[model samples]
Target: MSVIPAELDGAVIPGGCADCNAEQHFRQDEPGMWFIGIAHDDWCPTWRRIQAQRAGLPTTFLS
Candidate 1:
């Protein structure tokens, strides 16, 4: 199980994960293998999954 670090629920209302830094999560588990840190479901925004997919478009190389 994951431990809720102190700083996570500190002064910051939308307390983010000290390990990652996500903007949305429960006081529990998170999604994805590359967890950017558990976020505050009630405070922070959604997780960082779709955001990643929308990042810089993929590229292909050929000779």
Candidate 2:
């Protein structure tokens, strides 16, 4: 579950994890738009790929 208000425009990352459920929260402030956090299971492959991509590492998943 997210603490962010539902009225705020946001995006969802779908996955099969029962825990995290692969949701991302975003909010706009003085600094501009930013994601509050990423919710994903530790063992989720999608999360792994995302982390790899963010770290500038290559991933087997195709865009």
Provide the RMSD of all predictions against the true structure, rounded to 1 decimal: 9.1, 8.0
Question: What is the C-alpha RMSD, rounded to one decimal, of candidate 1?
Answer: 9.1
lDDT tens digits, residue span 1-63, model 1: 335553443233444555344454323234322223444343333434445556746545322
lDDT of each: 0.41, 0.62
In TM-score terms, candidate 2 sits at 0.38
lDDT (C-alpha) at residue 47 in model 1: 38
Off by over 4 Å in 2: 1-6, 9-20, 31-37, 56-63
> Candidate 2, after superposition: displacement of residue 63 in Å?
19
Model 1 misplacement above 4 A = 5-12, 15-24, 30-56, 59-63
Q: Write the per-residue lDDT of candidate 2 for residues 1-63, one digit (tens) a residue.
A: 435555564655464455556766555452444556668878878788778879884556646
